[model samples]
Target chain A: MHFVDRVRQRLDDAELQHNLKRTRGRNAASRAAAVAAFPDFDAVRARATEIRARVLRDLDLWLEAFEAKATESGATVLWARDGEHACELIIDIARRHGVRTVVKSKSMVSEEAGLNAALEAADIRPVETDLGEYILQINDNEPPSHIIMPVIHKSKEQVSALFARVHGTAPKTDIEALTHEARAVLRPQFLGADMGLSGGNFLIAETGSVAIVTNEGNGRLCTTLPRVHVALTGIEKVIPTLEDLSTLLRVLPRSATGQAITNYVSLLTGPRHAGDPDGPEHMYFVLVDGGRADLVGSDFEDMLRCIRCGACMNHCPVYQTIGGHAYGWVYPGPMGSVLTPLYQGLDKALDLPQAATLCNQCSVVCPVSIPLPELMRRLREKQMEQGLRPWRERLATRLWAWAAARPALYAWGARIAVRYLRWLADGRDRIQVMGLAPGWTAQRDFPAPAGATFRDLYARRRQGRA
Target chain B: MSTRDDILGRLRRQLGRTGSGLAEARRRIRDEIDTPRSGPRPSPGDDPERFIGRARAMLSTVDGCATMDEVPAKVAGWLRAQGLTTRLVIAPAFAGLDWSGAGCEVRAGAAGPHDAVGLTGCFRAIAETGTLMLRSGADMPPVNSLLPDTHIAVVPRTCIVPDMETAWTHARAEWRHWPRAVNLVSGPSRTADIEQTIVLGAHGPYRVHLIIVG
Candidate 1:
């Protein structure tokens, strides 16, 4: 579907709006409180940004170190050039272990790779264990609208209806009751699953470990209990040392959910060792390239610093109004505007860069201080340079440029433009009809020019003063 | 050969690096790993009182255990106060704590589906966020604290570190060998998936009771 149509349709959705409204205030308030609690938020953020920049500069070296250390620690580190290659590697691991049921925690990397569908096609049953993710999984495998809260777009009542239909249990309208029902259904799946897949928030090179943070214990359960554990993470996730993990950790949970730290922070180095009573016997770390390398040292390289906190989406005005699905991919909001276009070609997501209002809220709240609006602006410029923008928009830009270069002609054009708009407005403050730009006024009215142009007013004032 | 080279080559190209200059970058990262740098962080001075205060804010129940031997009695009193059964799953790592006087049903081993309360000792207690860092091995299953309805963790007053950075420093200095799994658990497992309202014990412990033992 077109991005504009999706946005229009989403705006009309009362339930989605209600759900977004419920979280918008709470998330923003809690995040503000969490940020207030920190005394050195910006200083620590700068330190983290430097760390990310250092890693990106020497990412290949860090990966080699991580691979060597992980290999020595008895973990097989696999690399993939893209998402399809990532899915293939995961499938191969499943087949080798003769696994059937695979339980997964919330992994945006897997979502980007479409791992669930690939596993299903291979006759492997993939179960989502996170409460929010499980809701989306049972409801026809909808891609997450938010990264941290995958089903933030869903309401409790809708979830109750879903549970009654899917679990064959009575509808649970209360949030706690609904949570318990989900736990009852997923606990057995955790104990009985043959394999587990998770996404790593940070892959530590010093310890050759994969670290994950979750408010729910599902991540721990998925990595434990199951005989085989496979962690699929982006190559950009690798950090040089455990100290770097600490800095990122400080910012991640606070920015993600306004928690000082999530309930569970799992730092797993490798599979279970001899005499160890629990943990997976087999462990594999698949570092997914997935076009992340394409942004290395590019204009949008700072974007790779995102920790999937969902703060960008939480604070974004555009995201709060229209929600995430309208952006048309696993990622959305300000970060998505820059990332989706860069990761998936600019031509593929032409409207994403223009979707943002360029308010810079995401950049200010970002833990790593990524210049998100600046990156989005660059993407727009790239679109113009590559001729990826719509022909009419391009033509309009050209015509404006032609008139703008000649000051007298520009003044003359502005005078005529205001008159035409006022005539269209028919004495109202806003124009109800637009000739060539009907899409702009179709949904709502466009504010009309009041009287003469600003240039004319300034010129008349100068003459009167003289 | 896999796609390692392809991915790395792309990164190297973008970073404007040649084969001859790669060794210097590799050495720098290895040196960084050996002697890690400490960046700006919240100063959580090692104070047991502050730890208790923070833990309380996160909804964890804290009780004072005057000594290691008093853990059993303190836990027994806590369980009774909560109106929960005395039967608890304990990790063999805590055999030194002596839970015989707790007057509670104590089973030792990994957590099972039916266990209501799981008790274990943490590798270190982080005073910054009032979190317990538990490392897997030495007959102490990480799930003993997880995979249960209620979790009772024993945090030694002496083992309390100022923050995560200090915790890692202590782990490196003493542990020598890294445990397969290291979990930093705070309060209890929770979820705000439904309308952003927190519901504790979504899949883990509903209540996390901390006994501050000296």
Candidate 2:
């Protein structure tokens, strides 16, 4: 099946209907709570934007400071220009350590680099310990559907079936019981894993530290319990100081899940200290550039300011319709729409930039005020300019744009199209299908024109008045 | 060139930086970080009682004592009231305290997997987000606060700060050599990942009880 058809089928699933309703309800509550929690919500968002802009403006200095400080604090820092380089560094670390099993908390960079596959290729087992990520991995290792809430697409009954199938356990109906089952299954993995890997939320330059904000506290477990701990993050995550981190933290949880603070925010500067009895022995920080540097001066430069809050997707109408999987990559939704095309190259993601309806909802709710719709439009223009669009779509757009340039020709063309459509309606008043645009007409009927076009109607009114 | 040099060079080229501009930016960032400016914070009222109230509002239970000696009894009383077991694992920092009189069996070390309750002392408590700041050290490891289902953190009244900014100020000055880990825990571990339904006790303490010693 084609990718678009598969997405439609998934969207039509009854289970997805239940899941999206739950997601919509939760997002509404979170948006309300976020607004209520921060009385100066706009001011906080503006401050966060300024801080991010400053960091991006002076990216080199902050990254250098972070690298220096982290190294000073006894961390081994590595750099990766692309995903393959990053995966190689991580796989090398695992191989050197003779790591049989590695546990990872949710790291989109790791997903972007396909770290699990690389590790598996080298005879290493990569285990996902986060409950949502664990669920995704156990079910054929599908990429996370949502950035923040990975399993928001799965219903309780589906999860029950998966657990019963995977663990040979009794089906669980209670959410708490289901959670307990996951914890029971994952605790051993956490204890037995040779190394732990995680993604850094904010890389603090001043203290040479990296912060991971999580509600489950698995971030701590992953970074602490294992012998070797590694954090894979993009270079854009670097901020100047802890003070700046506090500013971002104030808005991050509030904007993301409508919480005053997440349950745990861990700041790890290095591996275990000299006298420390428990924690990781060696810490590694792999800074991945991964095509973000290419966007440093582009029109879509603001895309780098994203903090991965999933707010844009939560607020986007198109994303709400098609869901994250349809976006076809590690990142999804409005931010993903711009990012996937840029990171993976435009040729590989022709349909993603066009997934939007030019709705300003994503940008309005964006914490950093990233002009997501504007970026998507720019990508669409780029795609058109480069002839990346499908032949039919390109021809149709060219024909419309050509006709639109001349007012008289556009009017005549519209009048003729209306007459033809009306005739095709056969007194039914609505067209159920069209040969030219069957996909558009498949879901909903198109209204047939009753008589003359708007221009013609206006001309008649003017003549009657005279 | 090495990958590091290539990445840095690419970033510099993208930013349109010349030779001297990089050094100037580095110097400016150094100055910026050295003189840390406090960010905007919520007005949770300027009182210790307000801190306690806010902490409680985050679903963390709080109790206060007139002195450090009274902390054990309060801990024992809370455990009894909640109908929980009296077995507890206290951090070594609180080892000298007499917990035997409180009708509870307590030990001082890291929390094991089977341990239901663990106690540790917080470096500071921020009233802004109702957060407890725990720095990892020999006296109190991270597992004490993390592994147990119920974590009882003892926060001295002097350590309660108005916001996160002030708390960081104190942390930077006090710990010249920063610890390996600094955990800012707001409440018990919770996740909304399951169909966006909030569930507590997701791999961290299900309950966090704060004892404020004056």
Candidate 3:
């Protein structure tokens, strides 16, 4: 019910509809152009997929290597089995260090764990440093619609309104001015915060380092100025070696924002070493395993190979229409459809698995070549297996199966249904309304049947030939 | 079991691997890390001109310095040309550079917010993306390039790498034990978070000037 309500709200919001149209189109085209410009995209993509596949095969091994190396490099490695544990670890770290404020870069892992609220509950101010994230943070903690561009759901005027109301300045329509407003506000937060929290883009198992990719320099500041830096990432983010980072980076920025490389790609090992004047003195990595470990060696294991590029959603027709908030979770789009069902239980997100049109656009654009549509289909099958799909849908499917098993019955039912649908059309080619399946025709016209079943046509043609 | 053990245990169980060969797999992982594999990299041409072109593409100003002795004067001229202040926060590596010759007073240490320009030397100049790979240390604080409104890096031509893979290989051979942070900055900070429009200088340096020493 909540998901349906959110979908209705997003669909009815004209500004959001316009923005999603522009956002999805521009994002998809930019990614295509970026991929087109790269001459060796196919080969590099192959290498990237190979690297991810290797990690998936031995995820535990890669994680162990990373943990050991991180610890050796003076980073305290913490493991969490769930989101609650992850939040608790970070809060505990803040309490131990007497950290009153945390300057955080945009981290999806932290978002999943609800780290900001936890930090607030612990009496530590958590500042969102990314421009988009800052906008969402100040405006009642709006969840990001798109992972890459969190505020893409809102229009420019909306952001201007929010900024003017919050900063007590005149509403500035220009993005440059609005961006500068955020820069001015967050600079002091970066300079004064006691702890810098970031999400690891890739955890290099060989060197015990965490790589963070960002266009803005907030990631650098969050890790550099603060006395303590804490990187929270999923356990599946680990890679075997630093060389693999180069392979992933080759496609990551290009696929995400159409940049050959983001403005900053920082591979931070442990804390500042001896004789280092700046950078965090204490570095910690809390590797969260919330449902990720369960994904290993499962049917949906390939979902773990996702680089969080958001390309799947950028190209998803369903997402383009309904937007991410309609999915009702942290991750959205095709990847989120699979992830939400698996991570948050299928019964809760049954509509998500069926949200796609199976256009295969998502898989084609995926940097790591994750078969997202197939994954969503698998989620649907899982829902059916668990009896989580709607009872009517299940019954309809079973009745169809029973009819399909009997050739004569199937032909008879199909012929009658086709005639009835043709009559419903009343000589028109398109039916605007259908009594049996009104939901299908609610938004778009359904094509009228040609008044003949496949079996009838086949048998008549065969008899005439004989 | 402790949280760590429980997670590792679940992961191992899902992976269907027993603890019998943990030591062997560890050795293999270490070997894989040590023996570097060069993945496919875009052909970032190996030349100072190519590096300069790429750097410019990333929105950085690249000027050539014929010798290390002329670095300070060049920095001053560039700053004046850009209508910036002559006061600088220089990294410890540039302590001996003659700032007086350029008519500028400079402080040698970590950069501060009030500092208008931060000057430092780069570990490597990546030609692939026109990026500066900065290794943080006492002599070269990462904030020198971050905190200031303007960041100027003097890179030697010998320090240029064709791609990121080579940068790491070079870093491994050079740093031995890696520095705390290795930041690869392409250009000025920009964000497209608002309406997907890129606005430069979001929270870091508004300008990135690269002075290459041949």
Candidate 4:
């Protein structure tokens, strides 16, 4: 089935409706609180955009500085041209370290690179320590339903049952109890794992540091307790300095979870130094380009400014109705509509760019101001130019364009269509069983076209008409 | 070309930049980083009372201590009130604070999983966000503030910074060489991943109590 039909099916799923309603309510409150946290939100957004634009303009230099500084700070920096290269570097590290078990923090980059499968193929077990990710990991068929909240589609009762079946214990109905159960299970993994992998939120070029923001303490544990730490990050995550990092941090938590500050914001430079009590002994950074560089100076370069806060999806009516799984990709909502196609080819992900209503809510809520609707429109134009749309839709569009060029033919066509539609309506105001567009009239009636075209109505009014 | 050269070359091509432009960009970044300017930030009014108020509002219990000697009693009392164990793991940096009178069994080192409480002295506390800044060193290790179920931090009132920018200035001035880890912790470890309901202590300390010494 096509993406449209799948979305339509999911739009009516009872389980999905129940899940999305809860998220809508929670997101509404968080967005309100986030808006209230900042005295001058727009000014901060403008500055952030300027900083990102500067970084993107000189991305290669900043990356070079980052590599040099991080190496000086005792970290080994490696560059990967694509996801395959990134995965291979990580697997090779695992092999050399004799890593039997790996504990991972929540990282969208690892998801994009398909690192877990690669590690598994090499006989190394990877454990997801974040509670939401752990749930998705156990249920192999379910991808993350939301970026921040991976198990947004699941309920506590369902989680309870999953724990009981997977861990071989009686299901506990309390929410806190389930959380404690996950902590108990993942603690040993943290203590015993030879290596830990995480995604970088921002790689500071000045301090040779990686800034990670997480509400849960798993990020701190994953980066600290393991002997070897590997951070897989996109090239676009680099900032010029710690001062710049401070500005980005101010907006990130507010935009992400409405917190004045997240519980833990770790600025880790390299690994543990000599005489330091406890941290990773060695550190490695894999900077994955993966098609982001393709948009450096293009019209779509603005999309790279996204901080992955999930605010666009939280405010999107289309996404809230269909949920994230309907988008069928790593990213979802307005950001995903532009990114999925650009990152994973426009041919396979056509429905994503077409899914938006171009309401402009996403643009207003975006922390860095990406102009998402305009980008989506550009993607649609690109798709049409590439001849990726269906032939019937293309033919209809071309016919309308051709008729629209000549007013007399368009007026005549409109008059004939209204007359035929008046007969189809059978004297009723609406037509339920119409051949004009069965998809539109499938569940509800389409209103009859006022019984006269606009030109006819204007002429009749000029002639003292009814 | 190697992968590094290839990746950088592709970026240069897409961005329409020449080799000469690279030197200029590097210089600009270096100048900006050397002379840092603060950006638009929230003005929470950098005062001790406001800092304490904000810290309390974030669910962190803040108690005022007249001197360094008063920190142990407060930690012990808070622990007893909360029914936590009296066996505490103190950071080596804070080994001078007397814990004998507080009636608590104290050990100074990295925190273990079985340790219920860990105490440390913070580098600086920011008033803007009620955040405690901790730097990793021989004296103040990272795990002392993270691994334990309960974290009790002792903050000297003079070490409080007006905002995050001021904290950065202090950090640069004090540690010319940056520490391995610089943590800005605000409140206890928490998560909203479970059906968007906030649950405290997902993997770190469930309770974070602050003892402010004057």
**How would you encode candidate 2's per-residue C-alpha lDDT over A25-80 as one tens digit per residue?**
46746876877857977888888898998888878778888999999999999999
DockQ per model, Cα: 0.82, 0.77, 0.82, 0.82
Q: What TM-score does each of the candidates earn?
A: 0.95, 0.93, 0.96, 0.95
Put down candidate 3 lDDT per residue, A1-466, tens digits, no spaces: 5777888898898988988876668888888898898899999999999999888887777887888889999999999888889999999999999999999999998889999998898899999999889999999888888888898888889999999999999998998999998899899888899999999899998889999999899999999899999999999999988789989998999898888889999999998888888888899999998899888999989899999999898888888999888999999999998899888888888888888899999999898989988898888888888888779989999999999999989988898899889888999999999989899899899999876887888889999999
Per-candidate chain B TM: 0.95, 0.95, 0.95, 0.95
Q: What lDDT does candidate 1 reach at residue B4?
A: 87
By the TM-score metric, which is better: model 2 or model 3? 3
What is the fnat of candidate 1? 0.84
Give the Å error, residue A301, model 1.
Answer: 0.8
Docking tier of model 2: it is medium
lDDT by residue (tens digit), candidate 1, A324-358: 89999989888888888888899999899999878
- The C-alpha lDDT values of all candidates are 0.89, 0.87, 0.89, 0.87
Q: Point out the worst 10-residue segment of candidate 1 chain A by lDDT.
A: A21-30
Candidate 1 residue pairs in backbone clash = none
The TM-score measured for candidate 3 stands at 0.96
Model 1, A347: alpha-carbon shift in Å? Answer: 1.7
Ranking by DockQ: 1, 4, 3, 2
User: In order, how many clashes per candidate?
Assistant: 0, 0, 0, 0
Q: What is the interface RMSD of each candidate, in Å?
A: 1.0, 1.1, 1.1, 1.1
Per-residue lDDT tens digits for candidate 3, residues B109-212, read 99888998999899988887789999888899888899889999999999998887887888777787788888999999999998788888998888999999
